[model samples]
Target: MPKIIVEVMPKADLLDPQGKAVAGALGRLGHSAITDVRIGKRFELTVEGEVTEQILADVATLADEIFSNQVIEDVTSIRVEEAQA
Candidate 1:
């Protein structure tokens, strides 16, 4: 089996209220070093059987189409690797 990791995040140009609120809270809590905190989604998928290139490609497509919204979020990265036994 193999695991696929997909990361999706808001585009830089967009305003992230969640991130801003977190950053403000961190500053108030004396964690000023943490200036920016942009939140994102990470999806880990474990394939049932042997993983092939086609499977990886399909995963990427799913990441683009199903997992993320192109309007605000960007598919930052997608990775596929063997899963731990």
Candidate 2:
């Protein structure tokens, strides 16, 4: 079996309100050294039986189509890790 890891983040060109708020709060709390903070989502899926390039491609397509909002978010990265023996 293999695993698919998907990471989603706000588009680099757009402003992240949540991240800004967190950073502001941190600054107010005397953590001014923390210049920025960004939040993102991570998902891990276990794939069994079939391990093909098409399967992996489908997973990526599905992730982009459903899990992430192409308008406001972007797919940061996708990692396919083989199971440990």
lDDT of each residue in 9-28, candidate 1, tens digit only: 99989998999999999999
- Lowest summed-lDDT stretch of 10 residues in model 1? 76-85
Q: Which regions of candidate 2 deviate over 4 angstroms?
A: none
**What lDDT does each candidate get?**
0.90, 0.89
Off by over 4 Å in 1: none
Worst 10 residues of 2 by lDDT: 48-57
lDDT of 2 by residue, 36-75 (tens): 9889889888898756889879878987999799999999
Give the per-residue Cα lDDT of candidate 1 at 77: 92
TM-score of each: 0.91, 0.86
Most lDDT-accurate candidate: 1
